[model samples]
Target: MYDALVVGAGPAGLMYSRVLAAKGFKVAVVEKNEQLAVKPCGEGISARVLKTAEIEKSDYNRFISHVIKGAVIVAPNGKEVIVKEEGEMGYVIDKKNFLRVMGEYSASTGAEIYMKEPVKELTFQKDHWLVKTRTMELEAKLLVGADGYLSFVSRTLGLEKPGERKVIPAIQYVMPNVDVHDPDMTYFFLGNDVAPKGYVWIFPKDGRLANVGIGVQGAAPKAYLDKFIKMHPEIFKKVDILEFRGAAVTIGGMLSEIVTDHAILIGEAAGQVIPLTGGGIHTSIAGGKIAAEVTAKALEEGNLSKQRLSEYKDKYNEYWGKRIKDSLKGLHAIEKLSDDELNQLAEILSPEDVVNLANGENVASVAVKLLKHPLFSIKLARALLS
Candidate 1:
């Protein structure tokens, strides 16, 4: 029996395995897909993710696709607000290679990674878990479900899943040779006419290549993306679509309870994603590190009870709970706004306010800003309070 068995080879599982193995734990990771990063994603992460993943600066070029400095927010009326920071803001990565690098690094640290081995069943004995994959039966002292939104292990363990309303459909295309206005900055287009309850994003890589994507609620995501592309001829007229990808994203905040008697949930499986932006890379990396460390401590102490694993939940919440809750509130309020209201909000919000609100910071300042707006003083106040 292994010390820990992680389901899924995504960022969380790989990171968890890497950290645990580095601590001298016997860890194994099982993935359903033959490859990694097959899901559609915006592929953006803040520079802080490097520290959280414990990646070396000398090895960044192995997976870094583009170094981004900031973002451009375009209002419904096409008015633009540019957001920039003092140093490097984020990175657009070659996601497949990034996961592979992390997985290989984990393997080098003594974690066994099994790809294309979809978990078939999970049976709980008194003190350990019997995991059945297609070809073999494995046992583990601790089971971690990082299996993602449709996590089989979570369902089998009777963990609470994110509600359907909290899940959104997203689609993206990898287009090269497009007329990119600024390859250094990612662009966000916001308007109901464009994406209804969601937004359109253009994350550019080197050489004018970009991943243009859309996430929408209560509408066909591909249809909306195509319509947006067709409407923005200035950007898409001559661009060739190199790839099309789609996936379901969880926009819900973190779940209330992620630890069971002898199991733990992390990553998308635990709804640890930013609600308004549907971003999870940074959060997942941080969550994986915390979970692994907590599991390691619990193992060393010879206690695998839920109370022991709850430290992971406590630490993760201490770091991200408020931000996620605020972001979820922000999402609920913004999604209820009409295009006209969004445009008005664009007029009232500054670049700093946008950045702060997006990160679930300075929310009171945002409310104060909205209260100063003659039209939004009461209407949005009620929305925010609700």
Candidate 2:
């Protein structure tokens, strides 16, 4: 029997496994994919949360495709705002390399990674979790679910979805030879016409290659992407389409419950995704490390009760619960804002304000900042109320 069994070999699971192995606990990680991180993602990771993950800079530097210095945000009415700071602000990483490093690190710490092994069902008996995979059954003192939004373990456990659960269908085109305005900057387009209840992004991986994508609350993502390209002929025209890929993203904020007596959920399974930006890399790293610590303590004490595991929830709430809640409120506010109202709000908000909001800062604090610009307060009020 292993000390811990982790489902899904994504960033979340790998991080948890790595921590457990470092603590001298036997860890097993199961992943369905033959290769790691082949899925569609924005591939953007912020520097703020990297400190928490404790990934050495020299190790991940090879994976950074581009250093994003700032963001160029275009409002619904085509009004533009630039939010950035001195030096590098974030990274457009080669996610495959990032996952490779994480996997290597986990293995180096004595974790047994089972690739292409999909978990079938979970059975808890005799103070151990019976994890039934495609080929065999293994027992573990603790179970951690990191499978993602459509998690089988979470469903099997009968944990209800959080109220903030709103899925966005997103599509992306890997276009090479594309003429971009700035490779150092990430671009965002906001409006119902471009992306209904969502947004469009252009993150450059190189001088001539960019990830052009759109996330929409509505179903027709392709139609909106077509419209977006037509509107920006100067940049997208004559570009060679490398490939197209997409997946559904759960920007539903956090889940209601992420822990049980003997089972714990992390990453998307726990709904740790940020609502406003649909970014989960930072949150995943933080959650994975936190859960690993709680699990290690639980193992040391030999107490695997849900009541003890609930400490995971308590720690997460103390750390990230309020930030996620504030970001969810900001998401609701954006959903309520009109095209004109959004433009007005964007114009008045400083880059610092945008940064704070994007980083999951309090919306009420943002409202207080808007007091300097009186017109924004009314629009912000309307957005909040709506």
Candidate 3:
């Protein structure tokens, strides 16, 4: 029996496996996909995550774009506000290469990896958990579900049902020769005309190559995405489509319980994405690290009950749970803004306010800026007063 069996060899699973293996745990990571890092995602990681994760500069190579700036928010009326920040702003990563590097790192630490072996079910036996794959049954002392959305591990572990709200769906594509100014800056388009109850993004990868995507809540995301793209002929005219993809992002926040008697859910399986921005790469990696730390401690103490596993919840709450709750509040505020309201609000905000919001600074500052607007002032005042 292995010390821990990690399902899904994505960033979260690999990171946890690496950390655990380095600490002398017998870990194994199983992946359904034949290759790693092939998920359909926006492929963007902020500088804050890079620094916090201790990702070395030498490990970047072709996996990173060093343009250190911020993003541009464009309203429906063509009004644009560029939010700038100091230090390493963000990176547009080649996610494939990055995942390969992470996999190699985990392997170097003696974590066994199995590709093309999808887990079908999981059950608890005497003093161990049994993971059932197509051709084999693996037993482990602990199970970590690092699978993405639609995670079977989470399903079998009885944490699959989303609470009040499910995640939004996103459609993305890689466009070549796109004529976008300030390649160092990412762009977001707000308004129902572009994406109904959602937003569109243009993240530059390199010279004239960028990732263009849009996300929308509710069903029929593709319909809204199609209409949004068609409405923006000016931006799409000079672009050549290279790749097209779509995926669902969990943003409703974590379930009431992520850890049980012998299983734990991490990453998207636990709904760790930021509700406002729909970004989860950093949070997922952090979740993996935290899960590893908690599981390791539990193993050392010879305790693996739900009570002992509550350490994962406590650590996550101490670290990122408050941030997730704050982002959810912000999401609700943004959802209340109409196109005209957003455009007007953008005019009222200074560059510093935008920077503060993006950098996860003071929430009151952002609320105050919103309150300055005549239309939203009353709502903001009520929110502040309450």
List model 2 lDDT by residue over 121-196, tens digit each. 7898989999888887899999999998778878888774534356788888988866778788999899877788
Query: Is 2 or 3 the stronger prediction by lDDT?
Result: 2
Model 2: weakest 10-residue lDDT segment is 377-386
Judge candidate 3 against the unseen true structure and give its global Cα lDDT, from 0 to 1: 0.79
Give the lowest summed-lDDT range of ten residues in model 3: 377-386
Superior by TM-score: candidate 2 or candidate 3: 2
Clashing pairs in 3: none
List the candidates ranked by TM-score, beginning with the highest: 1, 2, 3
lDDT by residue (tens digit), candidate 1, 1-386: 89999999999999999999999999999999989998888888888888889888888999999999999999899888899998999999999988988888899999999989999989999999999997879999999999998888777877774453268899999998666688899999999889989999999986878999999999999998899888888888889899999999988787777898889999998888888899888888888989999999999998999999999999988867677777787888888888889888888889998887787766777878788777777766545554
Q: For candidate 3, lDDT tens digit of each residue in 117-228?
A: 8898788898898888767789999999888877887777676753533778898888887666778888888887677777888888876788888888654766766676
Order by lDDT, highest first: 1, 2, 3
The list of candidate 1 runs beyond 4 A from truth reads 161-165, 379-386
The alpha-carbon deviation from the true structure for residue 326 of candidate 3, after best TM-score superposition, in angstroms, is: 1.0
Best by lDDT: 1
Show where candidate 3 strays beyond 4 Å: 65-68, 162-165, 355-361, 371-374, 377-386
